[model samples]
Target: MKKVVSLLALVMLLNGCDDGNLTQEDINFEDIPTQSCSINNIIYKLKDEESLLLEIPETSFTNEPSTVGEPTLLDINSANRVVYRFYNGTVSATNICETIPPATPIVTDQWSAIAGKIQIFTTAVKTTNATDNSTKITGYNHNIVFKNITFAKNNGTQVYETFPFGDYVTTANALPFLFDQTVEQCSASKQIYNYNSSEALLLDIDPSLIVNSATPLNTPRTGLIGTTVNKLTYRLFSGLLTSGYFCTGTIPSTPTVSEEWVATSGVSNVSGIIEVTTTTLGTGFKHVIVLKNVTMKKGTNDFKLGDSFIYGELLTTN
Candidate 1:
C-alpha cells in the first residue's frame, strides 16, 4: 500500500510538469516581429474653389488619398502669395488664410501660389512582445518631415514658403494580438515654394500688438528692417486699410531725437514702447496715427521686435 501511494504521487507531479505551465525564461521573446513603415511622394493641386485637392499619381504605401486631410494655409508673403501645408490627422493647422477665391485661377492670378513641391516624410517602428498567455504590441519612434523642395522664392514673384512641419510621435500601447497597424501617415502638399531667408520678414510681427483689442486692427506691416540683427521689423497701422492693401514700403530709420516720452517701467518691463506717431499726409486721411518702432530693453541689452505685425483702429472718447 505504501509503494502504491508513492507511485500515485510521482504520477501527479509528472502530469503537472506536462500541463504547459511556463516559466518566464521559457517564453520566446525572439518570436516577436518588428516592422518598419514609410510613405513617400504624394502630389496635390489647387482647385478652382480655393480648396487644395490631393493628387497621388503614385505611392509606395497602401494608404489612399483619403488618409490625407485638407491643406491649410501656413504663411502669406508680402505679394499676397500664400504657402500651404498638409499633414495626417495627427497634426492640426496653426494658421489659415482668410480670403479663399471662388474660381479656378491660374497660379499667377491667385493671391496664394506655390513655387515648388511640398513633401511630407515620416518613419515609425512597430514592436511586438509576448506576455503570459497574451501578446503586447507597441508602435513608437514616429517622426515627420514637412518642408518645401526649395526655400528660395522667385524675385518679384510671390510664392509659397514651406518650413519644417512640426514633429509629433505617437504613444505606445498594447494592441490586439496579430493585428497590423499603421504607425504614421503624413500628407505632402503638391504646392511648392522657393523660399529663402530674405523672404522671412513676411512672417514677422510686433510682439506688443494687441490682437484682441476691443478695437480690431488690420494685418501689421512687416519687412526686413536692417542687417544689424538680421531680423524682420513690424510697424502697426492704427486703422484698417482697403481690401487687398498691405503695408508694403520702406521701413523708416529710428528717430535720433527723443521726445518728452513718458517712461512706464515694469519689473518685467523691457524698453519697447507702442508709440502713436501722427503723419500729416497719408493715403486716404490727412492725419494718421501709425504705430512705429518697437524696441525692448532686456537688462543691458536692447532688442527690436520682429516676426509679426498688426494694423487696427483705437476708439477713444473726445
Candidate 2:
C-alpha cells in the first residue's frame, strides 16, 4: 500500500509537467525597439516569434508636450486594446501591417489585455543653438506605460504592476518662413511686416524707433521685445493672405491664424533685442531691421533668431 501511494504521486507530478496549458510562458520583449504599422493608430514591438501590439487612439500621442505634473491617461477597452501574439515562425512588420500579410507565420497562442490603464507621458526633444544658447523643439517623445494591467490567456491570467511599452517619437512641423528681403509697414496699424502667401512675420514697432533721422553707423537704435510695446509676432494662416492684409480696420475672418509664435521678452541689451540701423536713402530714410539674440517661443518650445538676424529693410518717406 505504501509503494502504490508513492507511485500514484509520481504519476500525477509527471502528468502536470507534461500539460502545456497548465503553466504560463514568460512574455517579455522589453529590449526590442518599438515599431509602427502603416496605420497611424497601431504600434507594436516584435521579438523573434512573439509580437506585442497596441491598438491605441491617435489622440493618445499628441504633438504637444504634456503638462508639468499631468500625464495623459487612457483606459484599456475595445477601442484601445493590447494584444500579444505568438507565432510559429519568426515575425516581422509584414505580419501585422495593413498591407497584405505573409502566409507562413501563423499565430499559435494569443493573449488579450482585459483591464489596464495606459499612461502616456509626453515631452519635447530639443536641440540647442550653440551661438545663442537657445533651444528648438525638433521632435516629441511619448513614453507609454501600462499600470495595474491584466492580460488574459486561454486558461489563466497574467497581471503586471507596471509594463513599459517604450518610447514613440514624432517630428515637429517645420516653420514656413520665406522672406525675400522686402518689408512692408502698415500705415494705419503702425505694424511692419514681411510675409509670404501663407505665413507672416510682423513687428509692432515703438513709434520712436522708425524716425526719419539717420542713426550713427556703429550705434543703432535698439529696443527689447515686450508685450504691449515693442512686440514681434510670427503667424501661419489657414489660407493665402490678400494684399494689404494687416492694414485693415478690422482683421478679416477668412484667412484665420492657424499658428502663432511670439518673441520672448528680455532685458534691454541682452536677448530679444530689435536693432534698427537707419541710413539716408534717396530722399527717404532706410531702416535695416535686425534681430539680435531673439528667441521665438510657442508653448514650451522655442527657437533662436541667431546672434544677428537681418529682418529686411524698411523705407519711410518723411
Candidate 3:
C-alpha cells in the first residue's frame, strides 16, 4: 500500500500539472528596508512586508550555548544582523562560539537578575556560541509530520503532502526542498489568512534561518531552507508554493484574493511564467516550526513522531 502511495506520488510528480515559468525578477536586497529588534543585544529584523524570502547568505546559528558559567556571553556581533542557517543531519544553532570554552556550564532558570530563566553549559542542545540563545535546539533531527494541514478546497487552497526533511547532508548534493506552504509568520504585515481551520501554532519566519557551510548563499528561509521550532523538524513533503492563479474569495464579505502554494521539490532550474512588476516582492518561502510533546487534538494520522508541536513556519526570506 505504501509502495502504491509512493508510486502514486511518483505519478503525481511526473504527471502533475506543470506550467508557469517563474521569471527571475532583479530585486535589490539593499533597497528593502531593514528593521531591527533585539533582546539582550541579539538583533533581528521582522523581514520587510514586501520581502518574501530574504536570502541570508551569512546569517546562521541561533546558539543556545549551555556551556559552564553564565553560558558564556555569546557575541551577537556576527549573527545579530541576520537570521536563519542550514546544516542538515544535525541542524544546530549558531556556532558563534566555535569551541566550548574550557568546561560545561549549568542553568539556574534565572538568566541574570531574572529568576525565571537559568543559563547552562554545552549539552546535546547547545554546542556553539556566538549570537543569541532562544531554544536549546528548538527543533532538530525531527520527523516533520502534518496531520491537519487543511487545504481550502479541491480548487480552494489544498495541501498535497506533508512529511519530514531528514537532515541536511552538508555536502554538495542539492538540499531536498519543499516549495510548499509557509507555516510561520515573518511580520505582522504578512498576508493574514482568515481560515476556517484552527491555528495550533501561529506562523512566523525563523530569525536564525541562515547558516553557511560550503554553500555561500545559505537559503535561510525556514519556509524553504528548513529549521525547528521548540524541537521537531518540519519541512516540505513536496514543493513550497502553488503556481496557480489567485482565486477571489471573501471572509465576512470583506473579499480576499487567495491562492495556493503547491509543494514541489528538487528543481533548481524551474522558471516563472508570470511577470511581476513590483519593486519589492516576496520570494515565496515557507516558515514552519515543529513542536514537541503535545497531544493531538485532531485525529489519527493527526500527529506523527509522537509529541505534538505548537509552532509556525511562514513564507519569508531564505
- Highest-scoring model, lDDT: 2
- Give one digit per residue, the lDDT tens place, for model 1 in 80-182: 2323333322211111221342332323312224444434333333332222121121333222223342223233232223333232333433221121111
Query: Runs in model 1 with CA error above 4 Å?
Result: 1-113, 117-120, 125-162, 166-318
Q: Among all windows of ten consecutive residues in candidate 2, which has the lowest summed lDDT?
A: 17-26
Residue 182, model 2: Cα distance from true site in angstroms: 1.6
lDDT of 2 at 183: 92
What are the per-residue Cα lDDT tens digits for candidate 3 across 230-293?
1222222122223121122322222222221221121222211111111113554433333322
lDDT winner between candidates 2 and 3: 2
Model 2 off-target regions past 4 Å?
1-26, 128-136
Residue by residue across 108-212, what tens digits does model 2's lDDT show?
999899999999989888887787665667888988888888888887777787888888887777676778777999887788999999888989888888999
What does the lDDT read for residue 157 in candidate 1?
35
Using alpha carbons, what is the TM-score of model 3? Answer: 0.16
Candidate ranking under TM-score, highest first, comes to 2, 1, 3
